[model samples]
Each structure stands twice: as C-alpha cells, then as structure tokens.
Target: MASPAIHIPHGPARSAHLLQRTTAEWRERGEDLLLFAYGSLIWRPEFEYAEALPARVLGYHRALRMRSSVNRGSTHQPGLVLALLPGGSCRGLVYRVPRAIGEEALPQLWAREMPNGVYDPRWLHCDTPSGRLRALAFTLSRRSPNWTGPLHEPELLHIFRHAEGRYGTTLDYLLRTVQGLREHGIRDMELERQAHLAARHGLCAPP
Candidate 1:
C-alpha cells in the first residue's frame, strides 16, 4: 500500500539556533555532561561517548506517545513513537561525554533530537549501577503539538500496521526499541505487551 505524502517541517533551523544558545549556556558551567537514552538513542546514539552504563530515571515512564509525522509516519497518517511520559520510572542507558568534546557533540545531538522542537531537553537525576548522576534527557512536553496522549488501542494498532516514513514503518521502530531494551537487560512490560500484540496480528511491514 502506498503511504500518504507528508510535509516535512522546517523547524530544524530553529532547533539549530536554540542549540547554539543552549550549548553556550551549558559551556559556561564548565562541567562534564551525561545523556540518558531511553528510546532510539538506546541503539542509534549517533554520537561519541566516553562511557555508557545502565541507568534508571525516576518519575518518568516511556510511552509510545509521540506523533511522528516525518521520520516514522506521514502527515496524513501519523504514527506513534516513544516519549518520556510522566509518573513512572524508566530503565535505559546513560552516556558520559567528556567536557573536551561537549561543544561538537551537543549541537549534533540537538540537531537529531530537536528537529521540530517537540522535546524539552532537560537535566534529570539518574541512578546508575555505578553511581548517581544528573543527565540530559529529551522529554515530551505535554503542551507540544506532537504529543499524543492516551491513544486507544485500535488507533495505535492501525498506526503500527501501516504508517511509514523516512526511517521506516512504525512497527519496525517498536520492534527495534524492544530489542534494544532487552539487550540492555531491561524489559519494559508495556512495550513488550504491545510488541506481542503486533507480532500476533502480523503488524509488521514487508522488507
């Protein structure tokens, strides 16, 4: 089946501008930085890191609640992506970036993550097996236009079944995230359940 055409947003320029301003502010502090990867970053960080460790973030849960209008779905038939929803905890990876390379890395990270400024990147406390740390995390601001709160099963399933975009199908993103989490010894019950349903119903797209 043919997917609907999508209008890619042009907010990446704004994101780049914000990155310059924000990273400069961060640089003023003169400290090492850490990034918490809960979704795609768990597998495709696309950046250099000095070290990585298993980490748990409190007070936020990973939800398949972001609307992807370009990468994983079209504007006409938007798909669901993972977002850091409030009220629970998430187990993921924390990447430590050395201060020497912070400038080069932060802008690149922002360009990838804040393309449309749908996320609010903030520093949140993390509990790692090694120790405690405050790490930068891209979280969904409920007020963002891309936030999809509390979708019904039928709608979500439909998205998983058909939505496709630049990256791939929605189902592929879901499956990959599940695989990435498992490799890190973390099993997200909600994602696992949804994945089971997807597999059982043959929601995956053809290669």
Candidate 2:
C-alpha cells in the first residue's frame, strides 16, 4: 500500500504570514529551505544539510518500522529504518539548506536515510523560535504493509541490533536520539525509559 499524501489544512490567519515570511527569507537568500528530521539525520549531519536548528512540529508521529521491502544493507547487515505511525507525536530538529543546494542534497539524504521506498516526503508545518513555518518531512509510504502501527522499544532494538551501515550501527541512531532528547529538554517518560532499557541491554550505550 502506498502511503497516501496528507494535506494539512492551512493553519490560522497567522499561519499564512508565517509561511510567507519563511518562504520569502529562503527566496531572498536563495536557500533551499528547512526540513524536519526526526531520525538518523538528527545524528548524522553528513547525510543532509550542514546547518540544523532545534525545532518541533505539531500533529505528527515518528516510529521505527520499514515502509518498503527495499532493504538498505546486506542481508547480514541491515540498516536503521523509520516508519510513520498513527496516533502519536514526534519531536526533532529542522535543517536548513540553500534552495539550489537542496536539489542535490535531498536525493543523497533520501538514499542514506530512506534506502527503500518505505518512506515518502511531504510538506509539514513546523514550530520554530521565530514562529510556525513550513518544512519538508518524510513519512511512511502508503503502499507499505507496515504502515500505521505501534512501534515499541523492543521492536526498535531488534532492528537496531543487527543494523550496520557506512555511518554507524542502529545503536548510534538510538544514542543520538537520547542525546537530542536531553539537549531539547523534552520530557517524554516513555522515550526516556526506552533509551535507558536499550542502554542497559547493550543494544545501545549511553553517551
């Protein structure tokens, strides 16, 4: 099942102003724009933009399920994966790139982060220090059989335990998320507990 595209209704009147300001800034600077990354990109700067700003987006969720069967790594060494799920929320950083540069950057980022067709890109509204703005985000592909499911800690650990790629292992992805959560002062008990458990079991080591 291909993930269906979502069209978020335009926000309040102020939302239009916010988006216009952001788009104008990018246009003026000739920059590509911002992308909201809640997965490996948070930790692996090399995969995408050079500069990232800590930001959040409302009305979205993040999970660790494969959207497509196009596996990233060798059969013996799988790669870290991300799947968009329903009825939960996510927090992550927003990265900025030059508009011209993003044309080249997005495909590379997608290749590294989304090796399979499991994930698809979409436009989302993000909250930043300045205000609400638009950003590009990746979500589970509607075509994925694994779409819209609950992704618990144990399931995520199982995937990470066997993951290996050019950048690092699945553990690296988990640990970086832990650090990011702390840095942002996010108070999600479930995520905190999961990170601790993954560390205790040696699936991931605390930094």
Candidate 3:
C-alpha cells in the first residue's frame, strides 16, 4: 500500500507576521518568552528551556480537536491532536527559555507550531505554583477549516484505530499525552476518557 501523504494546509504560517511582531514587542520590553506546551510538547519538547513547571491558563481548554496530517496522523485518515480552544481552563506545563536565547527561540517555535497556520498564537496569563506568567498559547478557532467539531466516541475510536502519520499512530499520541498529564498531576478528563475508549476497544493497550 502506498503511504498516506502528509497534509499541509495552504497559506502556511499565516501567523508569521503576528509572531514576529509579538517577538519584537517582547524584545523591546526585555521580557523573556514563555512557551506553553499542552500536547506533543508535553512529551517531546525538542527545545532547550531554563525551567519548566505546571501551569494553568484561563478561558481555554485542551481538546484532541485539531486534525493532524503530519505529526500525529496522515491526511488519508486524519488523526486528532490537542488544540487550545475557547472556554474553561487548561492545566499544562510552561517553559521559560534561557534568557540568552529567549528571543531567538520564537522563530523556531513559530516554524514548528505555525506551519499550517491553524493556531492563533497568543500570550495569555498562566497561573503556576511559582507565580503567574504570561505564556504563549497555540489556540485554534472553531471557524478554522481544520477544526473537527465535537466528534462522538465511536468516531474517535475509528480514528484511533486507523490513523497514522509521518510521526506515528494516533493511539501513541493520545497515550503519550495522557501519560504526560498523569506524570505532571494534571487531569484532563476528556483525554483520559479517550484513552480509556482506545484501550477498551483494543485500539491501544490500557494504561
């Protein structure tokens, strides 16, 4: 069988201008950049950070709502990835870039997260054990073409069973995120439910 082709949304990096502008603003203010990681970044940061701590952001919650044709699943049977959507709050990790590379890191971060231009990147206030912080968040608008709104359990199970992308299977993605959250003592009920569904149906092994 031919491998599934990766899906790259058109008009890549639509937020490049905004990211650059925000980076400049932060630089002008001499502020260190804080990168918020809720999904894959939780398990695999692939970046250097001075410190990391559990943090919570208001008015947005994490959902396996974004279609992934590259990192998590292929275009043929698109898998879901974590998306920060409006309403409620999300508990995740926040990383502070080493001061020397704080500014330099924004562009690299943008290239990784903004490739599909699916996220509306913003610096929102994060409440951490150490203190409150202004951390950058990748938010997906419901109106986006990539948004798969409110899929039921069976639909999600099918995706979990079949979806695979350049990186790996969707099951791994969900399991890894669940494990990361458990390790950090962050509870995401929706994600936990999804993992349970996957394991119960033999889509993945139980945690």
Considering every candidate listed, which one attains the maximal TM-score?
3
Q: Name the better of 2 and 3 by TM-score.
A: 3
Regions of candidate 1 where Cα sits further than 4 Å from its true position: 1-10, 205-207
Runs in model 2 with CA error above 4 Å?
1-31, 47-51, 67-80, 141-143, 146-148, 151-160, 202-207
Compose the digit string of candidate 3's lDDT tens values, residues 32-100: 668888888888887788889899988999999899877677768888888999899999999988767
Alpha-carbon lDDT of model 2: 0.58
TM-score of 2: 0.67
List per-prediction Cα lDDT, in the order shown. 0.79, 0.58, 0.80
Cα-based TM-score, every candidate: 0.87, 0.67, 0.89
Q: What's the C-alpha lDDT at position 86 in model 2?
A: 45
The positional error of residue 61 in candidate 1, measured at the CA in angstroms, is 1.1
Report the C-alpha lDDT of model 1 over 39-113, residue by residue, as the tens digit: 989988887888999999998889898998877889898987888876789999999988877778887777666
176 in model 3: Cα distance from truth in Å?
A: 0.2
lDDT of 2 by residue, 121-197 (tens): 55677777767767777665444554635566666666656666555565565566667666766544655566677
- lDDT measured at residue 2 in model 2 versus the true structure, 0 to 100: 22
